[model samples]
Target: MNGRLLTGYVLRRLGQALVVLWGAITLSFLIVQLTPGDPARLMVMGGEGGDAGAANEEQLAQVRADMGLDQPVILQYLGYLGRVVTFDWGTAYSQQRQSVTDVIGQGIGSTLELGAVSLLLMTALGIVFALGSVLLPTAWLRSAFQGVTVIGIAVPSFVLAIALLQIFSFQLGWFPAFGADGLRSVLLPSITIALLGAGTLSQVFARSIREVSAEGYVEVARARGLSPAQVVLRHVLRNASLPVYTIVGMLVGGIVSGAAIIETIFGRPGIGNLYVEAVSARDFPLIQALIVLTGGIYVLVTLIVDLSYPLIDPRVVSPAARRTR
Candidate 1:
C-alpha cells in the first residue's frame, strides 16, 4: 500500500478501536450499575450483611448521597464518561485511599512482564512446532506433534496450570509454587500461557503452510533448485505467516484476559488478582479502569495485526489499495 493509503487505514482502525473501547466502557458501567443493591453500600459493607453492617437505612442513604450514588444512572454514567475521557479514574473504594491509576499501575507492570514472557515463548514455540509438524519427514513425529497440539487445546489453562504446579512444583520441586518473585517464578506460569497459545497457533500455522505448499509458487521455487529448507523458509513460511500473524494478534487478548485465571492458579500478583479483589469488594473505579485497560489492549493488538497483513503479503495490500482507490 502507498503511504497515504496506509496512513488512512491505520487512522480508520484507530477510530474503530476508540468506538469499541467506548462500547466496552459503557457496557461495563451498565453491568456494574445493574447489579442488585447499592454499590456504595456494598463497598462500605464489604459485600457482607453482618453485625458490622448495623447501619440503618438512614445511614446507608447518607453514605450513598456522599458518594453521589443518589444521582440518576444516566447522569452518573455521563459524569463517569467525562472523568474517564479526562483520565481521572477516581480513587479506590475498597483499599487504602489510592488513585485507581496507581492501583492498576502496580499490577499492570507485573502483568505486562508476565505477558511479555508468555507471548515470546508462545510465538517462538508455535512457529517451531508448526514448521516441524509440516517439514518433518517421519509420520510418527508429525502425529506426535499433532497429538500435543490437541492436548494443548483440549486442556483448559487453569487445569494445565494446576497439573504443571503439581508435577513441577510439588513432586519435582523444580520451581516455586507461587509468587512472582523472579524469572524462576514466572517460568511455569509463562509455560502455561504459551502452551495454550502455541497449541492453537500451531494448528493455524500448519494449515496455512499446507495450503501454501500446494500453490504454484511453491512448485516454482522447488523447480528453481531452491533447497527444501530454502523453499520452506523463504517461500512457504512467508506466505503462511499471514494466518499465523492473524492468530497471534487475536491471542494477545486471550493472554491478557486469561491472565486472571493463570495468575490466580499460580498465586501470582497481577491485574488478574487485582480484578478478582476489586469485584469481591465491589470496587467500581478499579473494575472500570481494568475493563477499559483490557479492552484497549485487545483493540490495539488487533489493529496492529490488521495493519501488518500488507507487510507480510503484497497480495493483501492490493485489496486494501483497490478499496481505497
Candidate 2:
C-alpha cells in the first residue's frame, strides 16, 4: 500500500511480463522453423498456390539472405529479439514490398473497435445477469436468468455467430450479415463475442454475491432496518465486485484471441482475419508479429489487473510486500 511496496510490486510484474514476451517470441520463431519445407522457398513462391519451381536457386538464396535465414539459428533469434523490441517487425513475405507493421495497422483499428464495443457489452450484460439472478423476487425469474448464462457458456462462439447471422440478418433483417461499414455491422459480431464473456462473468459474479451476502457485516446492515436495495448497494456490491475485476481482466485476453474466429465468421476485417491470411500465405514475419502482439496484449491486461487489486481493495497485499514487513 505504501510507495516502496507499490514500486516493488510494479517492478516484479514488469519482470514477469518480460519473461512472457520472451516465451512468445521464442515460440513464434520455433513455429516458423518447425513448419515443413524451406521458409525461403515458401517466401519466394509467394505463399500457397504459387509456382514452386518458378523461383530459381538465385532467387531462393536472395530471399534467404534478405530474411537473415542464412545466419545461424542462435544469431537469428538474437536479431529477432532486438527487432521485436525495436518494433521493426520486418516485411510481409506474401505482400509486395509491404512492411508487416503496415499490414497489421490496416486491420488493427477494426479489431480494437470490435474489442472495445464487445467489452462494454460484456460488462453491462454480466452485471445485469448477475444482479437479476441474485436480486429478482421470483424464483422462476432467477432460474431463467441462470439458464441464459448456461446457454451462453455452452454454445460455441462460431455456432452462435452463424445462428445470430441467420436469424438477425437473414430472417429478421435487423442487421447486416457481414462487413464493418458502420455501427450496425458491428452489432452482430460484438454480441457474438460479448455473450460468451457475459455468460462466464455472470456465473462467477452471482457466486461472489451469494458468498458476500452471507457475511456478518451484511447481516448487521440488514438488521439495522435498511431496505434490501440499501443493504445490497452499501454493503454487498463493492466486496462482491472484487472477483469480477479479475474475471473481466482475463476476459479481455479471451476477447482478443476470440476476435479471429468471430471476425472470420462475420466476414469482418480485423487482426484475426489478417492472422488467417498470414498463416494461409505462410508469411512467417507477419505471423510472428501478430503472435507477439496478441501475447503482449494478454500479458499487459493481466499486469494491469494485478496492479489494480490494491486500489480496488486496499486490504490486498502482495506476498513480497507482506514478507518485507
RMSD of each: 2.7, 2.3
Kindly report which residue stretches of model 1 are placed more than 4 angstroms away from their true locations once superposed: 47-68, 320-325
- Cα lDDT of all candidates, in order? 0.83, 0.87
The 10-residue segment with the lowest total lDDT in model 1: 46-55
Model 1's alpha-carbon lDDT is 0.83
Clashing pairs in 2: none
Q: Which candidate is the best by lDDT?
A: 2
Q: Which prediction has the highest TM-score against the true structure?
A: 2
Question: At residue 300, what lDDT does model 1 achieve?
Answer: 82
Clashing pairs in 1: none
Query: After superposition, which runs of candidate 2 have C-alpha atoms over 4 Å from their true positions?
Result: 46-48, 318-325
Per-residue CA lDDT of model 2 for 1-325, tens digit only, reads: 5777678777887898889888998999898678788887776575545787777899778767666789999988888788888988877876674898998898899999999999999999999999999889899999999989997799999899999999999999999998999999998999999998999999999999999999999999999999877887888998889889889988998898899999999899989998888888888888999999999888888888878877876656656545753
